[model samples]
Target: MGLLHRFANPGRFLRLAARLQPWTNALALVLTGWGLIWGLFFAPADWQQGDAVRIMYVHVPAAWLASAGYVALAVCSVLSLVWRHPLADLAAAEIGPVGAAVTAVCLASGSLWGKPMWGAWWVWDARLTSVLVLFFLYVGHIALLRAFDEPQRGYRAGAILALVGAIDLPIIKFSVQWWNTLHQPDSITLTGAPTMSTSMLWPLLISALGFSFGFAAIVLARLRAAVMEQRLRVLLLSRGNAAAGAPS
Candidate 1:
């Protein structure tokens, strides 16, 4: 808890987030834009899919961040529940919608990719179904946070949902192998070199990094705003109580 204690102060974190947000946003925009351009033009087209294969650049990274964002939310949920860290609640609240938005993007892009490749805009393939469930989990997390009247009550409920929803992440990862699916097997694997050529892989990696930085920027900005809002609420309530108690 020592490491956690150091970062417990909301004011300190807001200051740090102010310093970091611009840089992360800039990095995200530049890298993601360049990657898209490179992937669409310079990277060699897939022999099988030709120009349509470029959709992988966006779809893959959005899918990666959707899951990664959920993992972060789950970790924050645990911290909020176990340690009662104020910042942890703020993190879960801020990150939930971002995860949901990215998950939507992932699904939309996957559908776009599927139309030409599979001749269907939607399918019940194991991998696709798992990802769809992941999207719903994100939505549930967001909804749960907003469902309660008291802020802390909402946060606690959302945190529990986040943890339970974490079971979906592993399912999403292994669904391709656990059952037959139309989605291709992993092109990049842990035990062996990536099957893709360097030309195609490079842009995808760049786009992933870009999206990651963008996600960081958005999360930080949101966290800073949430901290400030809570701070303002505290000040207003304190003032109201003082005025009410004074010589009435």
Candidate 2:
């Protein structure tokens, strides 16, 4: 309750976000720039995939964030529903479209990389199918939230759906292990060292980190905008009510 009360003030959040945004944005730009150059130019190409492997620089980070962003949305949704934190709903709402966009980029780029390597634009492989489902889940969440006339009711419903859909996240992660698929196996894991050389792995890691922070920064900005808009609407409504009630 205390925490919620403290953060509920938009001015506080705006101040914190303003301070953090520049640092996060700068880090994202530097890391992304270095990662792309290192991955595309310096890292040795796969013996079989050749230069096509460079696509991973973009595809891998996008795919990772697609899942990560949804998890964030679900968590924020839960917070909003349970604690009724003012910014939580706004954060979740702002994050959904961004997550969906990342998922779309992952799929589109994967298909582009697949056409030459896999001989088709897409295969109904388990990983691909699960990712597709994840994409649909994002779309459904967005549609459901907007469906209701009352914004709070819509947010509540969307939050529930987001929580439910999060169960698919682990399934997507394990799809490669559970079923035969065209998508390659995970390159990095907690149990063992990454399969790639330092030269290649470092850039990929940098890019992943960069993309993650970039997503966070964008979400913060969007959430701030949402909060301001809501405040403006409330102010306008109050003004209207006051005008209607004034002495004749």
Candidate 3:
């Protein structure tokens, strides 16, 4: 209730986003640039895997966001459904393609890394299979949201689908553990501490945070555009109505 009221007004959201956007964009740029330089140049190569291990810097973060973005989409869907906030629906719709792109990057990079390390381009492993399903879910959401002539109906249906597809998120997380797979287990989780050394893990963390904020900034920019477009549509419709009512 309180949350809904705070952001319900487009004016308020626009102001808040305007202020936050610069900070987020700056932070994303700095962190991503530093992370990439450190990962690609300074970080020690794997003794066994050698240069191929560099791919993890990008692959791991993309895989993480592929699932995390959907969680965000689901939350926005719930807000749109229960509170009927127009901005929430717009944000969710705008976020779908970004999430899909990240998922594809994760899969493509993973395949490239696999060829040298695992002796094949791809295998129907549990983790790989579930991530593929996640990709399809993103595709379905985008398709369903644009399927109807009435935009609101399409958004409503898409929200329902987003919420339902969220169930697969947990499955994707546990797929590697639940099955004996070739993919390495999670490095960041397993015990009280991360499995990697500070030198390796720090850059990965920075890069992941950068990617998250980058996604947010893009979504906010798209949402702002959507709001303005809607406003223009309303203005045109009102003018058309007035002209039709006048003596001709």
Candidate 4:
């Protein structure tokens, strides 16, 4: 609670974010560029899938960011509900659009990857369908956040929706195991040795880190802008009230 309150100050957060953004942005570009080059050109082709497997370099990262971004959104929602953290609402508002974009990339890349591997652009497979649902959840959260004229009301409504939608995260994770899905089970697991070869795995991990950094960079930049905008609005409103109250 002490730590949360310390950083919850918008001005303090903006200063910290400003210092971190350049480093994150640079790392995102360098790592993503290097990983893509290595994965697309240098990584050995799969014995079965061959060159088509290159798409994993992009699709996998986007898939990861989509889920991870939502987790961040859900965290913000919790902070907003529990602590009434000032910055959390602003963070959630910014996260929704970015999360949606990442999810869209995941879905589009999955479709393109699927067409060659599955002989169809899409299937109603459990993993695929659940990810689609995740995308809709992002979209709905984005819309709900803006649905009310009063910002606080909208934030509260969106926070509840985000919390409710988070139930899908675990379902998305275990969908392949739980159902007969065309999507493959995870090759990488925290508890077990990765099934993927090091040649592919190294680049994939690098790309995922890069995407993670990129997502953080984007959200921080957006949050900073939002905080500044809110400050400006409040200043403007106070000035208008002051003038209206002044004697003519």
Model 2 lDDT at residue 145: 84
lDDT of 1 by residue, 4-116 (tens): 77878877777777888889989999999989889988899999998899999999999999999999999999999998887998899899899889989999999999999
Scored by TM-score, the top model is: 4
lDDT minimum window of 10 residues, candidate 1: 10-19
Stretches of candidate 4 off by over 4 Å are: none
Better of 1 and 4 by TM-score: 4
Task: List, residue by residue over 144-192, the lDDT tens digit for candidate 2.
Answer: 8899999899899999999999989999999989888887789899988
Task: After superposing candidate 3 on the true structure, give the runs of residues whose Cα lies further than 4 Å from its correct spot.
Answer: none
Looking at model 4, report the run of 10 residues with the lowest lDDT sum.
1-10
User: What clash pairs does model 1 have?
Assistant: none
Native-to-model Cα distance after best TM-score fit, residue 166 in candidate 4, in Å:
0.5
Which pairs clash in the backbone of model 2? none
- In the range 70-173, model 3's lDDT, one tens digit per residue, is 99899989988998876888888888999999999999999999999999999998899889999999999999999999989989999999999998898889
32-88: candidate 4 lDDT, tens digit per residue = 998999999999999988899999999999998999999999999999999898889
Local distance difference test scores for all models: 0.90, 0.90, 0.88, 0.93
Deviation in angstroms for 56 in model 4?
0.6
Runs in model 1 lying further than 4 Å from the true structure: none
RMSD in angstroms, candidate 3? 1.4
Residue pairs of candidate 3 with colliding backbone atoms: none
Please report the TM-score between candidate 4 and the true structure. 0.98
Indicate the worst ten consecutive residues by lDDT in candidate 2. 1-10
